[model samples]
Target: MNISTYRQLIPSPVALVTGANKGIGFEISRILAESGIFVWMAGRDSARIKEATASLKKAGLPVDAISLDVTDPQSVESAAQHVQTVSGALDILVNNAGIVNERRLNKAGEPEVIPPSQIELNTLRQTYETNVFGVFTVTKAFLSLLRKSPAGRIVNMSSGLGSLTQRSDPNWAYSVVNALAYCSSKTAVNGITVAFAKELKDTPIKVNAADPGYCATDLNGHSGPRTPTQGAEIAVRLATLPEDGPTCGYFDENGPVPW
Candidate 1:
């Protein structure tokens, strides 16, 4: 709940956060750094990673700037090597790098959908390439390091729109903006989290999908209901879970979200 409590809970653990240059990822990195972990601020742009790490450092938080493009295998491999060089293992892997290439403000007044006829296949493919495939690439690249920790945590940044329960409900709040590409990409993330958790059921690795709620970030044109700091709570919590914390689960800021 507080920085002091987080420090008491975890001391000097190594954590890698993707897309840490801004938004919820930035806030998550800040909070984790405040908790005494060496937060690796990872991003595609080398300058951005440096800026983010520097900003946190300026704020008196321990952070390291690391270049990582989740979509690029070479970049992910290089980042993994960086983690290995700093520490023998990685304790936390926050898959926060994601993209949503669709209509942000639906112009249909009420319920809106990307016109089926006009929906660009490239857009959907690109979203999947990042939101879905990129996560797998980064996690797999770092899982070896995570395995060395006593309690390894992998937190996938997802959204409520990923929930099949909500998607199926005709009256759901998110039903208005049916951006299939973005929504389905998140769903794929949730699936990946579950599959990873199941595969590691007997190990110390804990994998879970986290919904940040509607956070006001560049991804959403800052039109969300919550702040990035508030949006990052669940992600940070999942990434720092103790041995007894939930695994193979879907959670939001408040509690478990219906799958």
Candidate 2:
């Protein structure tokens, strides 16, 4: 924390977090910026992205709103190109954009038949398109910039519901919270994180999957246990890992979660 050490580090280290217009992503942007990082608030909606950046700016945070639609290849490439020109290197990448459709009802305790059979295929696909595929596209687009950094960090925003160990165990807390599309998509995100981590095993990047736990956000109708502030803690921690930090792992705020 000394002046010399701080000066040796990258001034205003750049961070890109997708789906940051609101909820957990927004909180992550705020927290990172507050910690002296230049945050790139990425989202699909133009106005929301501006609003997110404006709100953070009002708080005296250094944040830039960027249009990033994870599922759209053209949009991802364009955004990546812009970031390359401006920052030249991406120090941290938080893939926090995710979606769920099992809202408006107490489906958390519902039977398996209800969530899978009752929900439409289109709904399932739409959820995956946002939660899973979006993360892949965004990560792929920014991997090079991240590699250029001395201490690169990639925090894949995953969930506890994605844990197969929890799902298989009948006594586990997340076992009853059944939603095929949503949970499975997170599982895919975890797998993708592992794959990328393996590829960059010898590099300086510290890639890990972080579960924000249950947060009160629009995705779940704001009925979750924690607030967005509480949820952003782990995402920021994983994003700021040192050169010797662990990689290809899954963790919440307190510690690692069961995979």
Candidate 3:
């Protein structure tokens, strides 16, 4: 369909998706745009952002390239300002930018796993900088614009690896795959999601975290069985949630995930 035809689907809702230059973030942006939402596809790289945006536009999706580095405060501020100037209000904010430790595993299939004791502090810090702290930075920057909407939604791209419940289970498939840095960073994101939800309880804004369920993306070297399009389902659900939808919770494709 052409861009004009795509525009006639759902009532337009403005959305900003961070780390959307590729992978699950890009898939989520495509889905949102397919549903008639105008999406700002935000990423740190100018070249990648341009390429991704051009691809989406060619596909007749409503998407704009946005230079957003979640780890950089000034960049986040600039993105928020530009959105406000152009879109006036933001109906949804999807915090999807994050990183995983490369030292342990990749597509080549690693032989040795890096244990918690062996993991470097710098690696952990870098993971948190993008996964945990980045969410806080982006959310804070666009909160005002979100508040302007009749019903605002914040979707934090989280993972089941963060669940202490799953990690403690002996039979779970991913139980043995724990990488301390990435796991702990996601746990922190869940905390941040709940905290913001509580603080905004009385308002129309809803904040929730989504577990993409092991998608085959660059983060995992395409080893995961599920595709990015499949992984984006839960996030898209939460992003366009009804007025009565639950908030301050972590969810997967099936239902609520244990914190």
Candidate 4:
């Protein structure tokens, strides 16, 4: 089914999307707003947030700017409180905020690539700070508001490189694309997704990880084949799942991806 069809399943739900100033997060925010949902486009940069909000507003989307740095506890708390004060509750959250690598890639048309054995410990820590810990911190802060919603959904933006199963396959296309910091961080995201899903099994909340499938975004030096909007499809799907939908799973646009 297309995005328009999926939008019909979810209408007027309030959502918060981190890293929404650009790339897949921005596209996801746009899609959500276009679906009649009230979107909080959260980002760390005030200038980028303003520009993004203006661009979306110009396109007639219902979105508001929010300053949020997922790695900062105080920022996460403040953003959650703001959402609560304004919307009363949150129906959806897209944990799309993340980092690729600590070492900047200077080579044109190439992404940050480094061997696992040679990876720096500090780099790994930095990657996990945003990709893993940030998810936990933000989700915990928003649990109260999420619980109040009739149907609550949490979508963790993961990646195909995180798949241990796929990584082990020699024929896998991304097998040679190993980068310890970013890849392992997403693996932790998958584990985190299941942990929350299990804890909230009996509750109204559902948690799932999404693989955007190498979208051509700043995250990967714009080398990925898919468009940002296409990359957001799986995330949007999980974000708007029905009450009876599956949780504690990894998925892409087509269907479930191997863990």
Candidate 5:
């Protein structure tokens, strides 16, 4: 059935998740749909997104696909337009697309540490293109739709590595795995979350950041101990938060995360 027909049946809240073709993003999309929200699973690859949506459809979930490349302004605008034309309003938005380029693998195939001082400027720029700028672009594009909702929510996927407090602690477990580009980009995401939350404080819309706690995904070469489904729990919770839920905050599964 078409999106309109599906909406007619469920008529529930609507959500859009970026980079939802696989890994943590896919799990987030799955969880949101399972919760009765009509999900727009977006990704850079058209084929991948189609496949991802298909899997959800087979499971009898309310979902559709959107081809979105977070780094491209035109693509983002087009996606916003499509949503406007179809859903008219969006209730939740999860910015889950991100990348890591400064990491490498040794002969043992384990993650090799790259010192922050040695990270290339270009690598940082590339990382920000998807992780930082993409969040800004997609959020700006969808803010209008979100405002139309009675209670809008924004969930930005972040990482514990982005925490300045945790990173500064010499005893931090992952301190030795310093990846400047990836970690700093997530830090910027938290800042963006706070900025938007403050700006819309009086509105019904709530904005928050989620730390997935190093899930095993392609971004980290599948090295994390946590499963993608486990990582998606916090983001799904943030996206479906109640009107009285906290905003402008960073949280993990347990609770608040250090900034």
Candidate 6:
């Protein structure tokens, strides 16, 4: 049977993951699909998302691809409409689409970190466009459908770099790797997560942020020691949290991360 037929056959929970064509987003989609939740692997590139969903379908996982560009309001709305039309409601929404603009090529053509002072205003705007505004746009569009579910969950992909507490420490291991645009965007994501969680606390919906520690993804030139699958674990956990799970909180694999 085709993907649409497969989707109809499974009455399981549904999940939508943005930027799911590769890396940590792909892993989150894989894990969720493996666990019996029908997943919508969303991305801006149709070909990439198609390939991603096909890989899982080959393994008998319930998944399909959707064209979604988080930074575009029209694209986000269209994606939500498609999900509502196909699945009726959304059980989980993972805001995993983001970008890092704190790096540039050096004289030797090697990637070099751009310091906070040297970063341009356009770079910051571009980072926030996808990392912050995109989250708000997508969440607002799909929230009505999420509310339709008996239990809804929202997982915002944050980074440990976003932690002001860690950034404040002079002895922090990554203290030297400061990218103002990327780091501050994640901090804004954390703030957005808390705001949404607070607004929906009385309801069945739960919103939380996941700090998928530095993983070898395209966002960071694949320099991290951790693998994408390893980083995805925390997001999967937060996405599938129980009814009693904590909302409006930030967490990594180890435990709660200080605000």
Query: For residues 1-259, what per-residue lDDT tens digits would candidate 3 score against the true structure?
Result: 1233323322567999999999999999999998779999999998999899999899899999999998899999999999999999998899999898735554687744578898888998899999999999999999999999887889999999989999889998899886899888999999999999999999989999999999999887788999999999889888888776899999999999998
Where is model 5 poorest over a 10-residue stretch in terms of lDDT? 1-10
lDDT of each: 0.87, 0.87, 0.90, 0.89, 0.90, 0.90
lDDT of 2 by residue, 167-229 (tens): 889998767787888988999999999999999999988889999989999887787899999
lDDT of 6 by residue, 118-176 (tens): 98999999999999999999999999999988778899999988889988888977877
- All candidates: CA RMSD (Å): 2.5, 3.1, 3.6, 2.3, 4.1, 4.4
Best prediction by TM-score: 6
- Write down the worst ten-residue block by lDDT for model 6: 1-10
Q: Give the poorly placed runs of model 5, Cα more than 4 Å off.
A: 1-11, 107-110
Candidate 4 C-alpha RMSD relative to the actual structure: 2.3
**Ranking 2 against 5 by lDDT, winner:** 5
All candidates' TM-scores? 0.93, 0.92, 0.93, 0.93, 0.94, 0.94
Query: Per-residue lDDT for 9 in model 3?
Result: 27
Off by over 4 Å in 2: 1-9, 103-114
Clashes of each: 0, 0, 0, 0, 0, 0
Q: Which candidate, 4 or 6, would have the higher lDDT against the true structure?
A: 6
Off by over 4 Å in 1: 2-10, 104-113
lDDT of 5 by residue, 1-259 (tens): 1233333433588899999999999999998888678899999999999999999999999999999999999999999999999999998899999888987677898767577888789999999999999999999999999999888889999899889899888899887767888888999999999999999999989999999887888887788999999999899888877656789999999999989
Error of 3 at 178 (Å): 1.7
Give the clash count for model 5: 0
Q: Which is better, 3 or 6, measured by TM-score?
A: 6
Error of 5 at 64 (Å): 0.3
